[model samples]
Target: MTRVIDSAGSAYFGEAEGLLRAMRLEEALESYALAERSGHDPDACAGGRWMCHMLLGRYERAWEESDAIAARCKPDRHRFWDGKPFEGRRVIVRCLHGLGDTIQFIRYAPLVRERAKTLIVEAQPALKRLIEESRVADAVITWGEREPEWDQQIEIVELPRIFRTTLETIPAKIPYLDLPAAAPIAAYDGATDLKVGIVWASSSYNPARSIPLKQMARIFEAPGTAFFSLQAGAERSELALWRDRIVDAHTDERCVVPAAATLKKLDLIVTADTMMAHLAGAMGRPVWTLLPFHCDWRWMKRGEDSPWYPTMRLFRQPRAGDWESVVDRLQAAIEETIKGRRLVPPGDPGAQAT
Candidate 1:
């Protein structure tokens, strides 16, 4: 632990990771904060710290730190623009985390690739192969025995701020994900009504970000809404209780391909603060994203409208774990959407009815 403190005492790249793994969240966040103030380019470690702050429900501070990080990186945009484009420039998208992250960041692939001939680095074997072959990247490289050298590389999460996206300019469009085709699955032969893709839980990154599986019973109370299970990882086991109401897409072998296809079939996706929410936004699908009392900054500071995906309607918890209120508000919206009263973008005077 002395070495851990020593690492934290200095502006080291892997310091936050070690501190985080040691469960010193507050200390880790503080260390990152200190590093940023001390003329350190916190880089991806800074991003991780912001994510931790959000996960721990310290949102105001998280937003403050994220804004700081964004400010720090702003100068790079100019430097990058001044340089020659892709003439030996290597813009690296570090997606070696999970499928949802890769899926979420894939929205920026086209723009990043346009700026520089790019190489995508993915950890998951499935996504690595899919991204390599698909239209998302010029080339895809998986983590291997050697770290392939590159001239200039940026994390995909940085793309939005680099593009200067605000509440008015979210690149919200669907089919952002393009996976290879495989065998077709059974159609969602539910009660041919309002199809709602339900993602109650996420991979165990932030437990606070997820709502309980049992709380989903509140959504089922919405009459005539067909729910499909989109929960991935260990959370998929929770679907057994809602077997009748759900279509089992998680068990399928062609995981990413079918999931993307299934998302195309849905009228609406109701999800938590996971990558699915981002995926739904990317696809430009009509979605209701359930948010924590203090949400991820991309959802923006206020209102249900997300710049990330204009079609996505946000339902925030009035307080932590207040899924009842969140679900109730979403239910009313779903009822309206089902009856042809769509949830239009906020600020539309006509969007509000008497």
Candidate 2:
């Protein structure tokens, strides 16, 4: 009898996993709920539900689900901070995700600091300089280094849940991340032409978010616009194919600070959903983000503007794997902006209608 019940529960969990992979989030959420009701790994079910709620922009519910999920998965070696008043207690916040996630969530560090006596932020080595200068925490340490001593530890992404964040209540503070003053990349030669920065690809993990270099060529069709390549990594090699059409501004020493400083110099930035989008938005720069049909939850379901970044505009694919239409809309918008019409600011009813 016990074996039969266990097998049935496993089957429900398997169905849920299949639905999630197919991007049928609503169906997947139901299947996961069914699995939980059947007593098949409550933690896994809670985690799956958390993602669904997050994607749907039901952040308050997602926060609750994530807390339950984390409680079940937390390792016994580390003490988890329960978002209590930690007066006089030391805390360590670990950046356990991508660079973009760290940049987005690090805003919460200052909130955590209000309660803790000492706060240490562990981040990727590439972001050490930027995080240190932000002063969100008392100390900064790179990942994989010796673990610093603290009374309790929390993951950076988990901070949102700890603070019980909702879409309406997201701390939409701009310019939270600061960059050191530096000369703009030489590519920005003093010109009155509309200077546009572009990032055509993202990390290889989710290729769906990326637009093929050849498909994006139409964006260069707009005359009198100087395009600068903000793309880094091996993807930068693709510039050779453009025949000097887009100037590459990325370099070995161009860390977050320099890259951000360069982004601020541009009149506009058109990028796929990547770290560049977050960096540009955080700096309060005018950034138009190109997103896949099923984009990350932060962008929400449908809209031209983002609540998190007031200066950022969103251009989403009409259908999955349809970058052509998105590019068409982007091109039209670019042409309009070059003609002296600014993008409608966030909170304007007209912008929401767009």
Q: Any runs in candidate 1 off by more than 4 Å, and if so which? A: 1-90, 117-123, 129-134, 145-150, 161-170, 179-184, 189-191, 252-255, 341-354
Q: Which clashing pairs does model 1 show?
A: 92-153, 174-283, 174-284
Candidates in order have lDDT scores of 0.64, 0.81
Best-matching candidate per lDDT = 2
lDDT of 2 at 193: 67
How accurate locally is residue 172 in candidate 2, as Cα lDDT from 0 to 100?
84
Question: Model 1, 350: alpha-carbon shift in Å?
Answer: 28
lDDT value, candidate 1, whole model: 0.64
lDDT of 2 by residue, 25-81 (tens): 889899998887777888788877877787778888887886686667656333356
Provide the lowest-lDDT 10-residue window in model 2.
Answer: 345-354
Q: Which 10 successive residues of model 1 have the least lDDT summed?
A: 76-85
